[model samples]
Target: MKRRQTNTNFFDLTNLSGDIRGGAISFLVAVPLCLGIALASGAPLFAGIIAGLVGGLVVGLFSRSALSISGPEAGLIVVTLSAIETLGSFPAFLLATCIAGLMQIGLGFARAGMVSNFFPSSVIKGMLAGIGIILIIKQLPHLVGYDADAAEGLALFQPGGFNIIEQLRMSLGQFSGVAMLIALSSLAVFYLWGRLLFQQRAFVKNVPAALIVVLLGIFINELVRMVFPQLALRGNHLVQLPVPGSPQEFLQLFTMPDFSQWNNPLVYTSAVAIALVASLEALLSVEATDELDPLKRKTPANHELKAQGIGNIVSGLIGGIPLTSVIVRSSVSINAGARTRLAALVHGTLLLICVVTLPTLLNKIPWASLAAILLVTGYKLARIEVFKGVFAEGPAKFIPFAVTIIAILLTDLLTGIGIGMITGIVFILREHYQNTHRVRTEHANNITRIHVSLGDHVSFLSKAKLLKLLKNIPDNAVVEIDGTGSSYIDSDVIKAIENFGVAACQRNIQLVFLPARPAESPVYTLTELADNYRRNNSERGFRHDSQPHLHRQVNPTPI
Candidate 1:
């Protein structure tokens, strides 16, 4: 028998080319977002990059999730900013972040990460779609060369109460033709590669289209600078990476956490908040990334939590922001053909190497080109087919999926997920109400015969429906309530059944209630037992209140 390849090995060289290509493209995409998130969090620009480094290197090394990329999460920006302000210093906040990591480690050991299993599949898909929509909308300004609101693009609302749509409208009027050219040109190249090159050419497919687009963007912009200097993209229009001139200046980038503030209660409070938020984000990302994996492999959630905890600890130690698995970067890596964790390691390594050695080279790439890459990725994530597939699964799935997308657009991620979760739970309860029991009625002469077959493992959720069902039985009817099929029936349901016997006597209905089988009962089919009970009861004849005598004779299971 052949041994199955369950997961890709850490040092697997079979996919080195693809991992490198994916990693390099991911590195390109991550740089600006890292800077943008750090700017939003009121941290040093380099801090986000450092978090990305620890997330990718440390978390990736230990995480069981093959494609999940961890880094400075945009969702934590408000939390970090508030913590920093409340703590009176960034270093103090860093100490809190380190404490948060310890808490996350505790949660992992306690297996709290399994809480992610309760999230409905529809909600997870909706989250991906919501993030996709956000990406497309937020990147629009960059695609058009509008750079004023760069740091806050990921936020749903700006400081002036302007939404993303308003920002888009404002940016359109002041758009740069040069930036538009680059973005449009890059998108066109992506379209061509997807439509023609990927399926037909093997060698060329190995080289990521994103890399080609970046190189083309550089060549075009440089050419424009030489020939028509006025039309060339410049300054803020391109990536702005802060370069360190000396070894001493590079050392200044790393900030140590302030350990003296251990006595402050605020630090502990901040730690709890960060721990909860970061762990939730990481678990959600793990779930979403697993859904996107072509191999359909599942990530061990607790392992992922531990990995994220370690990443955050190292990040805080080095003056970096709190880190979590980010779905956007993970999706980008998946789309770029990453097959192993090595891609994550490579991306982190590139973040360190490029910032130190090729910051000038990175500065040449236009934001428009990067935006084009994200736009394509966003389209893929929220494709029409995904919506169609969910819709085909019926309203039970689609409603939550659609609601989650809309909620995320209207509010933030966690709030939207909570709403979606509640919506999913409502549907679940509705299903339980309708499906807990099956009722069939037949007419014979002037009387009615009704059979109520309880479902396996009936719970308290079905209590109301069961009572309503019992109340609706007409007078002068013969009722048989069978629970022989149930492995475990709730006490609430049993009480309802017991109470219905009293109502049956008043209504002049004959009731025969069969409780669930006992654990030590002999091996006998439920159908056989139900048939034997009906035969015996009919032969001896039953009164309107024969339930007590019937139970004494048969000595049936007590529930």
Candidate 2:
């Protein structure tokens, strides 16, 4: 709950050299992701760049999270796509983004950022794994140089990832052998590059493997064009970063939101969905990134919401897609030795400069290579290690995790989370019911003993099981409902006990309920029930020991 207390001024340029190096490293990684996510999100390629810029320049300055990077995310692909489809226009979707931004600001103010804390970690992992699986599947066509629905995006579900079998069928029939070769080669390089240099050389590890992969794709494509002209890929097979030769031409890329659609209910609906999902995704990323932080710095979730809110507002106002704190980019920043948020700011600025000045060079980067990079990214997300880890937690944990993944694949992000949450709640309730109390039955001589011990803080949720226990007491048995350890008991449970105590007479069961210490513990009234039964069955023979019990009901066969 403590503020991100620091003695140094936030903007102090104390480590200019380190900031520059770290920022440059982060920038190298951000370029491809910005383009890839943009392609996936069905937004103008420039939108991704702008989001990156605002994320760094605006959110980076405001965020207390020192290592997190923010931008358009693959996780929001379905949500963004659905919003655009429902709104019927990209410009209208931008308006929804603005609304989402304002909503995020409200969430920050209302302290609603803690909502992510309630989501079981397994569910969160499943969400990302689902997204990862979809990412790999969606990018398959792109990797093979078959962009049947190039403009639709790269996600397997929608916006960025949709059309699994249909697209694959078409892509296979009309596939580019040359593009597939490049993708395969690049993938191999990624595998070898990480294994070779990641742990071996500090400089090699710091420089992103994506840079090498992209360069190799470009070189290989150029070689194909020169040698095997018939097998070459052109147009959308390569990244289409518009070469705006002049400043005026660059300005033409920006699109404004349609304020006229403000009254449309769909706009508000889109905003609400974006606000909720984006907030959740950002907070989850923060959680993951903080764990990766070697210094173990914790980012205040509310502050993160505020930073993202401001970033999204700025991004939407400037014709950018909605953005969130993204793990891929943030982890890259951390791995690159970034000590402050300045690295993130530098990456955004670099994106702006590159898009404006190096459009031609940027355009040369092949989509297949980016697809290779993202494929690897997807693999990391849904790695075998993750599956093993989840499984090791046991079925009680793994079922919800596995179910969440399946649900997200079959449905949208929100629906999948809902299903996973329901599954998780079931296990939680089962655990609660089992641990709510202890029950034991014993028989000595001709008398039977049914003992029930309540756990601390027994609430209404424990009522049903307790009642069932009470009902199963044998005829002419001694029943002791112990509540001495329970600090609180629901009124419903108290009422149930009262009703059961009355029914005890007809059943001829001896009910001994231990009253808790209180002016009026629910168990306090159990003594009264014992009194009534004692007065009514005074003529009956019973046995008692020297416990001076709170409640001891005695009954032979009922009169």
Give the per-residue lDDT of model 1 (tens digit) for 124-188: 99999988988888888888888655453344653553387787887898788888888999998
TM-score of 2: 0.80
State TM-scores per candidate: 0.90, 0.80
Candidate 2 wrongly placed segments (more than 4 Å): 1-45, 74-96, 148-161, 196-198, 228-230, 255-270, 288-298, 327-343, 442-446, 515-559
TM-score of 1: 0.90
lDDT, each prediction: 0.82, 0.75
Find the candidate with the highest TM-score and give its number: 1
- Over 4 Å off, model 1: 1-5, 152-155, 158-162, 445-447, 519-559
lDDT by residue for model 2 (1-559), tens: 3235531124336645455555665565566566656776778888877888888788888888877888887667778878888988889999999999999999999998787677777887787687678667878888777765443232345443456888888788878887898889888877776685555977665455666777888898889899988877788787666677677888987889999999999999999999988898888788767766766777889978988999888888888888998776775566546666777778778877888788777777777887776677677778899999999998878999999889878776667878998999898888888788886666778888877778787778988888877777788888877776777777678788778777776777766667553434544333454455466644442222224353354332210
Candidate 1 positional error at 46, Å: 0.4
